[model samples]
Target: MPGSASPHVLLAGVDDATEAVLRTELGGRAAVRRLPSGEAVPPDAADEPTLLVVGADVPAPAGLVSALQTRTRHLAVIVVTGRAGADDTSALSLLAPAERLAYVRADDPDGLARAARSMLDRLALQHAYRTAQAAAQRRLLAGGEVARQPGEQLFGPLYHQVLIGAVAVDAAGRVIAWNRKAADILSLRNDAAGRSFPLLFPPHVRGDLREHLARAALVPSPPTLFERLGDDGAAQTLRMSAQAVTNPDGTTHTLVILEDITSSTETRRQLAERTSHALLSGDVAAAMTAGDPLRQRLQRSAQAVVDRLGVAVARIWTLDAQENTLVLQAAAGPHGHLDGGPSRIRVGDPGVGLIAAERKPHLTNAVTDDRYADDQDWIRREGMAAFAGYPLINDGELMGVMALFSRRPLPETAFESLAGIAGQIAVGISQDRLLDRLRATTEALQRPLLPPDLPTLPGLDIVARYRAQGDSLDIGGDFYDVFPLPDGQWALTLGDVCGKGPTAAAVTGLVRHTLWTAAQQDPDPAHVLPSVHRALLRENSPFCTLVYALLDPSDTPVRLRVTSAGHPAPLLRRRGGRTRLLEEHGPLLGAFRATGHPVQSTVLHPGDSLILYTDGFTEGSGAHLSREPEDLAALLASWTGPSDDRLADRLADLLFTDAVTRWAGRLRDDLALVAISAHP
Candidate 1:
């Protein structure tokens, strides 16, 4: 037992009124010391048991509480708090052990005094128990009998009231002494005094307990372990520590300490689970935006879930709207192969299909026992423990289903995470489908803006190649035309309008029609381009770049008139493989009324070609190097390939292939090339 010294109470941050109340309530019970304003914390060393009382008026009382706890192991606390800072006061509770802390409202000074007195009583009991336990351990180590005064009489009553469970088992592994707290914690029978200590645990853990006890009896230092008991739903985790104590009769006894840590373990598990969910959500979101194809991106998302959550299998299905069915698009983990599994499930079918039909989630911890889960025999064979299926719905439309099977039972948190992932997957699918529709619509609108086919003219091999920028989802503004005009002449115009989509497509139509109508009135390239430019300005349309050429194939050497309106000059490839740019320069059309559309006249001899193209051929997409006009001229100069009616297409293929190879198929601008050759 502790020396019969009086207990001390340290009062800090308390009003005179509260101090008087505490002193009156604890009068003659303990020595009361009022702390100075500077010394808010009690001294670490005290002659006897000590308690600290903190008032709510103290600035940052929670900090003081935490500091007091770390400064001394012997002090107990009674915090007088108000309703205002309930969260801060609650944090103080976790800082100290339950038995060593108490909280009372500041408004009730009487209640504060009562809490202080109760905490003091607990401190006294703890001090006495420690003193008696020390004496018992000393006697045992000396191989001497413990005297009755400080042994059973002093220790017995205090041991039962200790906060943690204490049980002493003899060398035979039978319980020799069991405290009231131990019985309450273990809920063993009244006859537990002589029962084998290891047998007190459930059958599965008894062997582990026996081995731990034996190891503890041979070691000087106590070793600890956290053991979980009960089934998955109601499991209780205990932090157990054991050490051997030798008795006076030369017999060995092991003292075991048991602390119920089920709540704390669950808290840690929940925290870890929440962190995993956040990372999983981030990973799935990243996968959704990854540059992979739609199916590959979905597959990556499925694989992420299995890798992050340790699930047995994860699969994603996409809706085939025409068939009204779910098609398995991605799979990971066991059953990862898409061929062998149920690749297609009709709406209202079992499992994933049912989720899609209902447009809701289906979650069950026991997949084998759930009647709604499909393929129960396979689940059982694979030892599947949990199943979660969520319908991938966006804006009230079913997109698909995402489902997973876990070998271990999953918690409610897993279902919540999966639901969020399902929504992301649904959005991914919807976005891809929407893009597909957009490309289709844009393509349909784009086709009519260009000539259906090049007109076949005698003595002239005319072919054109139009390639829209590959990287854009919107319709390109580049257009090309080859149509016969009056007086045995053919008009060839290739131009690129500003912007994209509907507005650009409309402008493209206007430019093509205006040029065709103007050429009918006059076959001169200069007059035709300026007329188109005037029409655009009259309509308040966006500006454009154009290359217009009037070809008269009936002439002996095929006379040509080409003009430029802020467009690249046409390339003229001579019959001997020499190349040169035509001298045609002008301002871009539709910007100003004073802009020029300068025309250049040239004669195309047999086996010679004239090529007009847009800027997309020179400027590649993304990080690709720009192909200058000189580069195109050099390319044309080096051409040893055959020049047939498909010469335009062959040249376009060569240039486009270089761009694709250099930039990995990401072409930035739209391209249009028109080639006119005289019997080449």
Candidate 2:
């Protein structure tokens, strides 16, 4: 016991000789104190060591020590009665159930001091068996150490029922004591006293608990936790820690603290799921939107897929003409010599090429398996354990192949999600290419039917702009023409057929040619319109609506001779911004033979514009479509376009700018706008 630290000790039932001997021999070995009376030591000394020494010189206590021990249930008592065996039963009865009582017979300084040290050492061993107080617990319980009493407690009532679930278990994993929260969290019925630790966790996760317990015992200072499922079938994530403690009889014990983290774990899992769903939705949106061209759009889509699925690389390879080779169109993410790296593969080549050739999707969790043994180098260089490749097709023809690589093993759903996005890419690429072909064909046919450039007529500046309906074949029933007439006069006409596409376009061409040839015979708007209507009377399937006007400067103020074939009336804005409508009414073309398409005349003042437009603007089924006649008149009146060169195109764009009801901003019908402004 040399160099042993001193413990707080209390002495009783001894004369001045014992007190002097204890002070001299036990000096610097223990903190010794004296009680004025053996039966009545201070109430605070009940928790400390109280030794009753009956020396040969000092008379023995007469049942007073037994009275003191009866009052302190947790006290340690010792006797030096100068006798042995059953003779010292009086002192043995004063010890607690788990406490040891020491006895001695010698009365010298060494003998008395040995007796005192033996009693203090037993009490100190009992305190040492307790767990190290948590720093947080010590901060809450006490700061400065106070004098130890016989029964004074350190762990007060303030921390007994704390929120944390605390349990004390033996070295055999049998529970000893647990708080109410531990009972509730583990779904224990009544008491957790005798239940084993393995019963608290599900069978599948018991090994994890065992491992944590073993590791915790090896290094008992710091605590650790493991995840498991509890008896309630819910995901029960418990934080566990164990520290080695000792019982009063020199047996080892374990103290554990369990914190329930089931709610936090569930929250994290749900958050990950929601985030993945949102990212998938965004990827679909980016692919479907027509904000970029086909190559760039497919590139963005592939990148989105790679980022969302946490894959290493993704690429879209389009099939070439011979269908025997695949061409890389877009690539994203990291792959050595793969991202914009000028790499190509034949149709039956390894990886993406084979997928495209067979028009089937391919997925493998282990790329290094026997089937892919030959591709080990490629797979290892990509650093991916899983790979997925999807072939993109439109109708029955293959469009492209999409291949993705991942460093982690992927689930079946990753392949399904990749297939879904591949379909979108296929549609986007096909539609864009089809539109390009349609646009080129439309230009070839439209050049001969529609006017390439308006004829330059003195005293008038004319311009026109056209927009076809939807992404359909660019050819439509809308048409416009401006041609020069005899004697410094100009002729302009705007018209719309009953239907769209090829049949209507044929009628449109017939109408334009008939109007021009009839003008050659007679340059009169009133005379030529009836001839054109008669020419179209035999065609009942496709009819035409038209507004024709002839400008003549024979008199001082120019004259606008206008004729309508069931078309929207033309508006004429004067020099002072006042608008007037030449509202001529006539039967629709092809409706009746020899129809009277009367000419309504209007005089064009200087700095004026004559507006000829189709019904696409007013009759469009959109929120801002202006069906009212006054809306057209107001818009015409506000045009200061007699001097600006971009007047015609600007007015056409404004017509549909506020009325975007279609999903793609395409017009429900074709738009043809032609503006003839009188030069200032």
Candidate 3:
């Protein structure tokens, strides 16, 4: 109803600079009206086909766009903006459906005018189609069978302008008539009239096409099928639907309709691929990071490849450099078993071993037909067709080999994806192997450096927890110790040496032993900390942070002498669940000469607790886990768990769990926490 007359263009907020340009470009093709920014759309504007061009500067442009869309069925909208990236422009662009919306930059007046003219042309086409539909309906109601004609006039203008390809064929499957859309969609050569419809399709599908046409001519509700045409590299998906129609003379013809759905089909396929890649990467990373043996991790990764990629079989092999042989490390799927012969292959052997020898990928879609694989009965039995074998190379060194077998031919694109997946798994395997060695070395060093068990002092309960940075291969230097001193006093120290690896570990040992010896000679932290400071400077070791607390448990409420050197202040949680920081600061040890060591003394009353930790407990990737002192203080005050033997363990667990969650399980530095709670 709206397109029954000439379309109207309503330009709102057209600046003076671009107004004349727009008018000249529009060429008086449509009735144009200039509406000020302050005015609302006219009440009668919705009565005819309308196009609204609103500027981005208009107040509440997104709201206006929504109102215009909902109020009329035949209105198209264009939003002109000074810049594409402006906030208002983005809001207006996304306010309406893409087909009914257009956006043009204000500086490009010609572009805006072109968009307006295009929309107007579309409106005219719709009006013509609607008019023809009404005339056809009228003729049918007036008994038109006696005077009906053939060809374009009989089908009316609507048939020629419609989007889908349409063809009319006789019951014998010979093409009688077809719309222009059919000729273009099918890439017809010369003339299509009097041609056999089935012959136009691929030779392989011609017989099936004939059968489908016959079925459609006989059935009232015909079936539809999707056919792929063109070369393999650039194929298109055509959805074909057929229906039987009777002419005025009672002759029946089968009407074939085709709609190109290549874009939508490719979109669905790409979405599936992305989902698969994400799932595969997650699974492989999870398996590699788990506390499992190398073989078990490899097995999990192999199973994931099979499950995610839909491969019939997947196998992994690791190279034994000593023997120059590749051994089957993991296998999954129907034929995935390592107990059989050829579990070990020499580097120069054929098939999987050859891929490793050359350090290149081997992809084939004719595994069962290849002469080299003809001897394998399983390949024939399983009807295996496609094979992809990639050498797992990391940093130019062959780590192993990964191979998969499939019963169907995989597209060329799939081989590229599989190659990339193999490379990812290779990197994961290499990292996991390195982590194994690091774990062994770190565990050995940690066992002696950190006190296996804190000394149990009278009226004093101490617990400490330590975790190296997440996914780190280097040894950490975070250490904690609780040792006894003369005069019934106890020395508790938590420290983080600068840097990592062997140098840091060496400094950690020196600091621990020096603190123990110093506290024995003098139980005061002020004297003990300075002595360790001198020891670090003498060794020329990296600068370190230390928190040393000398506890005299003989008193009713433990008298604590605490000293901090370039360390995070310790939290003092009172008996009533209130927490505060004991702020004592000193220069970093081993970094400067003549540095003062400051000490603060506090009494830990019965039912009170003291928490000492390294900076890693608070600092992490994002703001959520950033070093916020207030957040840490509040967290300590909210603790409701018991302060018993497991008090320190539970506290460390809570803090570490929260840190891991906020940082996404990837800590950038070593984390250590020590909780000392006085027993009632």
Candidate No. with top TM-score: 1
Report, for every candidate in turn, its global Cα lDDT versus the true structure.
0.78, 0.67, 0.76
- Higher-ranked by lDDT: 2 or 3: 3
lDDT by residue (361-480, candidate 2, tens digit) is 888887764332235666677676877888889887788888877889986666666777788878877787778898788777766778877776566567787777876475788899
> Model 3 Cα displacement at 307 (Å)?
10
Against the hidden reference, what TM-scores do the models get?
A: 0.68, 0.57, 0.54
| Candidate 3 backbone collisions, by pair | none
Stretches of model 1 off by over 4 angstroms after superposition: 1-226, 230-234, 239-260, 336-340, 368-371, 455-465, 554-558, 575-577, 605-607, 619-628, 635-650, 661-668, 676-680
Error of 1 at 322 (Å): 3.3
Cα error, residue 175 of model 1, in Å, equals 5.9
Instruction: Write model 1 residue lDDT over 288-365, tens digit each, in one string.
Output: 987788999999999989988999888899999899999988999967432136889888887777788888788888
Window of ten residues with lowest summed lDDT in model 1: 146-155
